[model samples]
Structure formats: C-alpha cells, structure tokens
Target: MRRRRGFVQFAILHLLKEESMHGYQIMKELEERSNGTYSASAGTVYPALQELMEQQLIELDTSSDKKVYSINENGVKHLQNKHLEGDFWVEWKERMMWRNSEQSIQLRGAVDRWEKEFRKAMKHARGNPESVHELIAFIDDMTESLSKKSTKQGDRS
Candidate 1:
C-alpha cells in the first residue's frame, strides 16, 4: 500500500489550501502529517510547486525572503473540483500502521470477521446457478453498494 502516485500533487495542494507556506515548510508539513510516509525531497516537491505556478493555480509572495506560496482563486476552484483531500490521508495512515505492524493485527482480525459474516450472507444469497445473469447483476450491485458505504465511512473518519 505504499502508494506514490499523484500523491505529491494532492499533498501540495492539500496544504496550500489551508494557508500560505514556503517550499521548505510545505515539505516539512507533508512529512509530519503523513508521518514521514511522504518525506519527499526538494527534487520531488519543488517541481510540482513550479508546475502549479505555471498553471496559475498558485502565487508566490516574493515580498519576503522566504518566497511563500499561496493558493490563488484558481487553486481554490481546482481543490473544490478535486475534493482537496480526505480518503488518501486515511489510506496513508492505514498503510503506515500496517507497515509498522502496529494495528495490522487488529485490522486482520476485523477483516477476518467481516469475511466470515459476508460468507454467511452469501450462503443465503446464492441461489440456483441457472440464474447466472441475476447472479452477475447482484454481485455488481453489491460491489457498488459496499464501495460507496466504505467511501462514506472513510470520509466520516
């Protein structure tokens, strides 16, 4: 679960949405918030900042020596469109715990219990194999419903 996808972009935008910060401060905040899971180097973060500026999503305050970066109107609109950040942070925390072997035992226990319950439900749910089309549709619906419920639960946490 060591996800290293568009996380750099999300982390940068997620922090800039809160308040203006310089490049070094942004890096530190990302590291602290992610518990060092995303301790990206300047080589990783600076280019994204530059790209955001190029896209006119962020503005640089050169009045001070720090060169603070503040999200502009366009950035706000972008974050609103992309939903800033939520689920990614939750998954990142879970991954960290699993990696450190801290809460993984608990997580495994919960998942195992859930699987047992789900199989029990499936036993009653499974009907004649002659209804293959209905079975497929039912499975699809269950997947969508479970995914949405899990997403809502994640957001709540």
Candidate 2:
C-alpha cells in the first residue's frame, strides 16, 4: 500500500531465488514469510509478474493447470548479481522486528522529552504573554528550518 517499488522488486527476486511459484502462491509466500507485514495483493503482484515476464526475468509454466512461474537464467543472474541468495527476506524481517522495537523506545524517549520541555516552557510563561509569543516565533523558525532542510535533501536525492 505504501508503493515501495524497491520492496516489491526485492520480494519478487527473493521469491524466485528460492523456487518457482504462481502469483497467488507468491502472495501467500510473501505474507507468511513477512509475518503479514508485506502482502502483495493480486492487483500488485500480477502486474509486477507481468513486468518481470516482459523483462525475461521469469518464464511461465504453461504446461500445467495453474499458471506457475519459475526463474529463468536472467532471473538467476539478477539474483546472483544482487548478492541476495537464500531466504534473504528472513534476515530482513528479523532486522525489521528489532528496528521497530528500537524505534518504539526512541519514540518514547522523544515524547517524554517533549512533554518535559512543554511543561517547563508553560510554567515559565504562566503569567507572561510574551513567552507565548516567543514560543510561536520559535516554532515558526524551527518549521522553516526543517522545511529548508527537507527541500535540500530532496534536491540532493
């Protein structure tokens, strides 16, 4: 849903690296492998598979009832060149789990700091309207600074 092109591509390549599967099978595999974090709907998976077919990364197994797909030489080369062999998604999922936990901790720390800062600032401005004005000015300045930094980074990227 987030429209991560790289993530989708990586999933396809990873799936093919293991073995051949159909679109539905790939979707089920992805959901199970990612622990439900990454799910490729038919709409998304089918189109991506079509693109990969067009790119000659995979070939269809038209000799069966189900339209299965297997990695071709190009797909194998792609996987090998990418240095992503084995169940690469497993390691990625593990790292993501740890990263999420770390982020939760960091978010808690940030929220606590923000609360403390806000309380202190409010206490200092209890009777002075000028402090409120200064707070607004500070917020505006920080917003402008963040906007500029974001714009510059986007430009660089």
Candidate 3:
C-alpha cells in the first residue's frame, strides 16, 4: 500500500502523544490502532523514533535497559499545528472495520492455516518441477472457483 511521505512519522508522533512506549509497544499499538491494517516493523518505527529525537519532537529515556520514547512539548505543538485528529483516522477506521468482524476473524484463521500448509508443501516440492506445476494448477483452480463464487454473490446482491 502506498502511503504519503512522513505518514509513519506522523503516526509515531500521534501515538507518543498518548503515552511513553518502547519500540515494540509502539509497533503493536500502531497495528492495534489501525485494526491490523498497518503492521509497523522495528525497522520502520525505530528509525522514525530516531528522526523524531533528532527533530527534538520526542525524547528517549535510556535510564532503563529498554529505551522508552515520549512526545515532548514540541511534538504536541507539531500535532496541534498540523491538526492530526482528522479524516485520516475516520477513513482508516472505515477501511479496516471488516478486520474486526467475526466473519473476517474466521477467514483470517483459515487463511493462516492455508498459508502454513502451503509453505510446508512448497518446501517439500522444491527442485521438483512436476510437484511445483501441480501446486500452481491447484492454486489457480481454487482462485478461479472463489472468483466465480464471489461474482455470483454479487449478482444476488
């Protein structure tokens, strides 16, 4: 998904405004806030935190083994000036609401199970052209079947 430049930074600042958090906590909080749509990685979050520190928008407490980050007064002013509370959050919530549904939860579980099995099968099929071809054909057929079912459902709707 393409994102606007500095969006990660903006999100980091928004999160820090609420409370101090470690890197992992920031990643998890971003994921949770976006309803699993935006999964923040350490690579992304840590660098953004470093940039925020450089800009003096946030501060890091290294008193403990784990570095905790908190938004400073400048960060609050930045958010206020930019008006962080806006349609971005409303659109994000609307877009990701499906992920919070019971049906979506079950579908996610099934997809995860399928992915695990697919990975195992791929590992076993490595270097075997015939096995790989069969797997591709099976996946193609499954995708076509699902597409047709979806089309039929749309017609009903």
Candidate 4:
C-alpha cells in the first residue's frame, strides 16, 4: 500500500503537526504508524525535510546525534490551512494507520478482495451485450458519487 510521492509531503506535514521529529524519526514513525505500508525512504524523507525547512514549516532542534525537527508556528498555520482545504484530513487518516499493523494488513486484504471482485465482475460482463452499458453506467455512477462526496465534504470543511 505504498502511496505516491505526493503522500510523502502530506504525511510529513501531518507528522509535524503531531510532534517534531528528525528525518530518521519521521521515517520510523511513518513505518511504525502505517504498519510498514509507508517506509518513507531516506531519499524521500530527507529532501522533503529540507523542503519543509526551506518553506519555514519546520526548524532544526538542538540534538546530539540526529538533528531533531520541530514544527514552527508557520507549520501549524500551514496545517490549519490544509485542514480548511478539506482532503487533508481524509488523506491524513488514510496515512495515520501506517502505525497500526493490524490496520495495514486489513487494508491490504481489502484491496486484494477488491481486485478479485473486479476481475470476477469483468469476466461475468465479458459477453453480454448489456454488460458494456451496465459497466459504463456503473462507472459513471461511481464517479458521480465520488464527486458529490468530495464536494459535500469540501463544503463541510
């Protein structure tokens, strides 16, 4: 369930919101929290940290071994802005489970089950003439529902 690189940025922002952590700490936290689904590779974490630092979202804290990072006032304000943006919370929730192993396994299982179901449905719909129309309508319905949900959720935010 490794997420896209965009997720790394969001995850870092959320992590900073919780507490200041070093790059390595952030990586470990992400892996531990998401059940290993998001092992923020060093290549990804370090650069993101640098980016955040540049953006004034975080700053280096005095530490002995590793440079600890803590969210600055700007960071909190940034997070609040993201909260107002609507999808940040949902994305954060989805990313937060990286800490819980059971949740991660469950998510993987759900995805596998969905893939199986999709294949089965495709097989069933292979021949029938009405199948194409049904599939199209189903896809349209799903897109519409998702759009409405996103819009409604945005308004609520």
The most accurate candidate by lDDT is 3
Report the candidate with higher TM-score, 1 versus 4.
1
Full-model lDDT for every candidate: 0.77, 0.78, 0.83, 0.76
Name model 3 segments beyond 4 Å from true: 1-5, 84-88, 91-157
Q: What TM-score goes with each of the models? A: 0.54, 0.55, 0.54, 0.51
Q: What is candidate 2's lDDT per residue for 26-62, written digit by digit as tens? A: 9888778767655568888888888788889889998
Model 2 ranges with Cα > 4 A deviation: 1-4, 84-87, 94-157
Please, what are the lDDT tens digits per residue for candidate 1 over residues 1-157?
A: 2334365776687788889999999989877877875566898889889888998989999999889999999988887787534576676655654655747767777878977876766675677564556656877998999999999999998
Error of 2 at 134 (Å): 29
Look at candidate 1 and tell me the lDDT of residue 65: 82
The stretch of ten residues in a row with the least summed lDDT in candidate 3 is 1-10
Superior candidate under TM-score, 3 versus 4:
3
Q: On residues 1-157, what C-alpha lDDT tens digit does candidate 4 reach at each position?
A: 3444556766787888888778888888877766555556898888878878888888897756779888888978877776445555455556555535687779888878987877787799998879868977987998899899999999997
Question: Per-residue alpha-carbon lDDT of model 3 for 39-123, expressed as tens digits?
Answer: 7787788888888899999999999999999999999999888864456655556545766678889997998899899999999
